[model samples]
Target chain A: MNLYGVRAIYKFEMARMRRTIMQSVLAPVITTSLYFVVFGSAIGSRMGAIENISYGAYIIPGLVMLSLLMQSISNASFGIYMPKFSGTIYEVLSAPVSYAEIVLGYVGAAATKSVILGVIILITARFFVDYHVLHPFWMLSFLVLTAVTFSLFGFIIGIWADGFEKLQIVPMMVVTPLVFLGGTFYSIDMLPQVWQTISLFNPVVYLISGFRWAFYGVSDVHVGISVGMTVVFLAACMATVWWIFKTGYRLRS
Target chain B: MQPDISVKHLNKVYGGGFQALKDVNLEIYPGEIFALLGPNGAGKTTLISIICGIVNKTDGEIRAAGHNIVTDYRSAREAIGLVPQELHTDAFERVWDAVSFSRGLFGKPPKPSHIEKVLKDLSLWDKRNNRIMSLSGGMKRRVMIAKALSHEPRILFLDEPTAGVDVELRRDMWEMVRKLRENGTTIILTTHYIEEAEEMADRIGVIREGEIILVEEKNQLMSKLGKKELRLQLQNPLDKVPGELTLEPVELSEDGYELIYTFDAQEQQAGVARLLRTLGELDIEYRDLQTRESSLEEIFVGLVHE
Candidate 1:
C-alpha cells in the first residue's frame, strides 16, 4: 500500500548495486564468460554435438542459469543481512511499512539485478557461440521466474543466518555443487543409468533443462514439468517468508 | 487532555522465562518531557521498543496518539519518532539520502526544505553530502536525531540520546530537546544519568526490578523527598548531646567536635529555628554552621536503594 516506502527501499538497494558495480555485475559476467571460453571452446572442440546442436552453444543457457541462481540468492541475502547486522532493521520494522512491502522492495531489486546479469551473460554468449531462442517469450518468463524464486530463497536465508559465515554456507556448499552436477556442461543421458535417475532428483537440473529448452528446444526433462517445479518452489519460498514475518522469527524479540 | 501515550498492565516475558517487565502502568502527558530512569537491564529499552511496535509484548494494551499499538500499528507508528540507543546508519549513504529515505519510510512526501531545516538545526547541513561512515561519532549521533525528526512526528522517544557523547554535544542535544518541546512535541527519554533527568525532565519515573516504583513531578518529588543536613562546629568538645536537644534528630560527631542535624527541606524554617532555640537555651557554643540540601542525585540513589 505504501508505494513511497517501497520505492525508497528499492532505490537504496539498487544504488548499492550501482556503487559496487564491479563486484555485483561485472564479476559474474566475467566469471561466466570464462566458463564459455574454457568449457565452450576448449572442451567442446573434442566432444561432438548433443541433439545436433554445437557443444559450445549447448552450454549457453546452462551457464546463464548458473550465474542467475547464484547472483539472485547472493544479492537478496546480502541486502537483508546487512540491515540486520548493522541494526538498521529496527528502523524499517518500526516504520509504517508492512512486511509485504519490505520483501517486495528487497526481492524485486535483487531480481532486477539478477535478470540484468542474465541478459548480459546471454548477450556476451552471442559473441563466443551460436545460440537461438526458440521461444523468446518463454525465455524471458523463465528468466524472471527463476530470478524471483531464487531471490525469495535468498531472502529467507538472510533472515535465518545469524552470522556472515552462515550466509556463504548454502551458496558455497550446496548450490555450487548442485549447479555443476545438474548438467551445466553435458547432458545427463551420458551418465550411468542409476546416476541419471539421481540427477532427476536434483532441482537445479529442472531449472537448467527448462532454460536450455528455451534456448535450443532440447531438454533432459519435459519443459512443462520444469516450469511446474519452479512454480512450486516459488510458492514454498513465499509461504516460508510469510511465516517468518508472522512469527517475528529472527526479526523481533 | 487525554494522555498522549497510555500503557496499562504491560508485561514482557522472554522465551527463557525471564520477565523483563511486570504489570507496569504509565501515562505520559502531551508537550512535557518525561524521563525514565533505571539501571541496566531494568527494561527501559523494552518499554520503549514495545510502544514503537518493534518488540512484541507478552501481554498489555498500549495506545499511542489515541490508536492501539497492536490493532492500529500503522497510524500509531506514524505518530512516533524513535532515536534508538544504538548508533546505526547506512555507512555508505550520504546524510541527505538517509534522512530523506527515513521520511519516505513513514509514507511522508519529500519536503526538501524541511529536511534542510532539520539538517541546519542539527548543524549537519555542511555534511549533508558526506557519507555517514566518514563523519565523527558526535556527528553520527546527530544524524540519528535528524533521521528521527525527518517525519516530524507528534511524539519523540530519545533512548539515551546523550550516552557516550561529549559535553558540547550533550549541551546541544538538551537545547534541541527544549526547542522541540517548544514546538509542541512530547518527549520521552531514558537515562542512567540523574543529572540529565534533573536538567530536562518535567516529570520523572524510576523503574526497578521491572516495575515502575515512582512517578512524580520533578519539583514535587524534590521537595517531598529531599533532606537537608546542618553541621555545627563546637567551640569545645562535649561528651554527649544535651537533654533538651535529644528531641531533635541530632547526633554528636564521633570525635565530639561537632553536631549534625538532618531534617526535611520542606520543614526547614520551623525545624531549624526550634533546634537553634534549643541550642541557645542549652548555652551550646558553636564556631560555625553550614547547611547542605540533598541534590536530585542523592534523592534518586535513596529511592533506588529503598
Candidate 2:
C-alpha cells in the first residue's frame, strides 16, 4: 500500500465531505443541539438526576452516540453511494487502488466526520449544562473507539446498499430503531426484567452506557461489560468489512 | 512487432446465465489501432472489460504486455488504460485533482509537471480549477481521456469513445488518437460508426452474438469480403424481370427503371461479362450504368449477420 494511494482516497473522501458540509457537519450539530434542548432541558428539568449526576449531564453519552451513529452511517454510506450513483466507482474500480485502500479511505473519512461531530456536540452540551468528566482517558477512548467502530459498520452498510433506498433502510430502519430502543433516553434497568434482558442484547446499549459511564463515572450497566460489548461489536464490524474486501463483494462483482 | 494483447478462447457468463462473451480470441499488436465493430450487446464491452480486468472471465486467458490480466493485474493494468463510454466524473472535484488522483491510484507519486502536461494536452489547462460538473459534455469526455492517459499507459482502450460526441470533437479525438499512436501507444477502439473504424483502424474485427466473426487487416478484409453492385438504367421501363434476364444474376428495380446485378470482385468468375453480353443480346438499351463498392459498414453488417 502506497501512502500516496491512501492519501488520494483520503483527499477524495474529504472532497466529498466538503461538497455537503451543510449536511455532514452542520446538520449533525443542529440535530444534537435539538437533542440537548428537548431531552436535556425539557425532560431533564422534571426528571431530575440519574446516579447522582444531573439528567442533563447523564444523557450526554447517548446524545454523542446519536450524533456519531448518524454521522458515521451517513458519511460512510453516502461516501460510497454517491460514487456509485454518479457512475464514478468505475474510476476507483479501474484505478490501481486496492480494496484495502478503498475501505481505509472511506472508513477513515467517516470516522473523521464522526469525531468532529462528536466533539461539536460535546462542546455544545456545555452551554446547556456543565458536566464533569470523571476520567479523561476513558472519555477519549470511548469517543475514538465508537467513531471507528461505527464507521467500519457504516462501510459495510454502504457496500450492502444497492440504491439510495437500500442505504437508508439499514440506518433509518435498523440502526436508528436499535439506538432509540437501546436506552438512549433511559436506562434499561427501569424496564421489567425480561425487557431489560432483551435491551441488553442491543449492541448500542453498551456503547451509550459505556459513554455515559465516562461522562459521570456512573451507569446502570457495569463499565467492564460496556467496554467488552463495544470491543466485541467493533471486532465483528471489522471482520465483516475485511470479509467484504477480501471477497470483492459489491465493490467488484 | 510483438503483440501487446493476446486473448485466447475467452468466455464470460454473468450470474443470470447471460453469456456476454464466448470463445473470443484476438491478438492486438503493438502500435496498431484495432477496431472492434459490433452492434449493441455484441460483446465489445465484455471483451474489453475482461482484458482490462474490470470483469472476470469465466474461461480463457488474457495477457497484456505479457502479464496475465487475472494472475498479475497490477502490472498488466498499469500497462493499459481504458476510456469508458460513460461520462462519469467527480462533479465537485477540480479537473486537475481528478486527473492526479487517477494517476495516484496507479501508485504514482504526485508530479505537478506531469499533471500540467496532461491537462494542457487535453485543452483543460484553463478548466483545471473549475469543478467537473461545470464542464460541457465534450469537455468531460476529454477529461475522461486525460485521466486514462495520465498514467502514460502503453495500451489504451477506447470503448465507443466517440459516441454522442459532436463532429468536431470526434475529429479532434481521432487526431489525438493518431498522435498517441505515433507516440507508440497501442490503441484498441470499439465503435458503431463504421466511418471511424474505416478511417482510423489499421485492422478491424467484426463481432456478433458473443463471438468474433472475422479479424483481418482493414483493406484486406474489405477486399476479401466486399461485393460490388451494378445498376443499369433502361431506356424502357418494365414492371417485371424478363424470363431471359431472370436466368442471370440480376433483379429488376421496383421502379422498373433499372436492373440490379451483384457480384464479388475478388471472385475469379463473377459472370458480370456474361450478364452484360446477355443484356446486349436482348437488345436491352440503357441510358447509363453505375457501380457501387461495399463500404466497411456494409461489409461489417454482412459479416455479423452471416
What is each predicted model's overall lDDT from 0 to 1? 0.94, 0.86
**Considering every candidate listed, which one attains the maximal lDDT?**
1
> Candidate 2 chain B — worst ten consecutive residues by lDDT sum?
B265-274
- Which residue pairs come into collision in candidate 2? none
Among all candidates shown, the one with the greatest DockQ:
1
Local accuracy of candidate 1 as per-residue lDDT tens digits, A148-234:
999999999999999999899999999999999999888998899999999999999999999999888999999999999999999
Q: What tens-digit string does per-residue lDDT give for candidate 2 at A1-253?
A: 6567778888888877887889888888888888889878888888967777778877888878988987888888888888878887876776666677887888888898788888888899998867888888998899888888888888888889888898888888888998898778887877999999888788888888888888787776899998998898889998898887666677664
* Model 1 CAPRI quality: high
Error of 2 at B102 (Å): 1.9
Candidate 1 Cα misplacement greater than 4 A, ranges: none
Native-to-model Cα distance after best TM-score fit, residue A147 in candidate 2, in Å: 1.8
- Measured as a fraction from 0 to 1, the native contacts recovered by model 1 come to 0.76
What's model 1's interface RMSD, roughly to a tenth of an angstrom? Answer: 0.8
lDDT of 1: 0.94
Q: TM-score (chain B) for model 1? A: 0.96
